[model samples]
Target: MVQTTATRLKNRLRRTDGQLQGILKMVDEGRDCQDILTQLAAVRSSVERIMGVVVAENVKRCITDDQLDTDQQAQLEAALELVVKNH
Candidate 1:
């Protein structure tokens, strides 16, 4: 079965949540600092990728939407730019 974008993103989020839980367990078990940092980095990368996908999808939708007036389109583009820049 084909997965929708939302489904794929949700799965990614679930995996990220699992990674966070693992990190917490690692902390409780006194795992090495470097190992924890590596896991943290992986989580960060995953989240960034999710964010990119979401932003790209939104931009694609906005660009293709025929009902949006010029002002609305500009606003959406600006908002997307802010999200990308802040991330």
Candidate 2:
């Protein structure tokens, strides 16, 4: 199960990487600035979503491990908040 989750996350990151490359190519081709910006925004959102998912998974693991103290939970929550706000 852990291996599956890692694989899925890796796939998500790879797809996001492709989108990033697409944005770079669009810029190189002198595509419409507005269109490029829109696509870039999408890429940013996709990365942010992936980050949120990874953070959630980490939080779940921490809780299950019984080793995550209050400070650790607070830190994770803060990280989650940052991702949510940025996304």
Best by lDDT: 1
Global lDDT of model 2: 0.80
- Give per-residue CA lDDT, model 1, range 1-87, as digits (tens): 999989999999999999999999999999999999999999998898789779867776757668788898788777776675455
lDDT of each: 0.87, 0.80
| Model 1 error, position 70 (Å) | 23
lDDT measured at residue 63 in model 2 versus the true structure, 0 to 100 = 70
Per-residue alpha-carbon lDDT of candidate 2 for residues 9-87, written as tens digits (9 for 90 to 100): 8998899899889989999999999999899888888888887777777766767536678888788778767775565
Report the Cα lDDT for residue 12, model 2. 83
Deviation of model 1 at 21, angstroms: 0.5
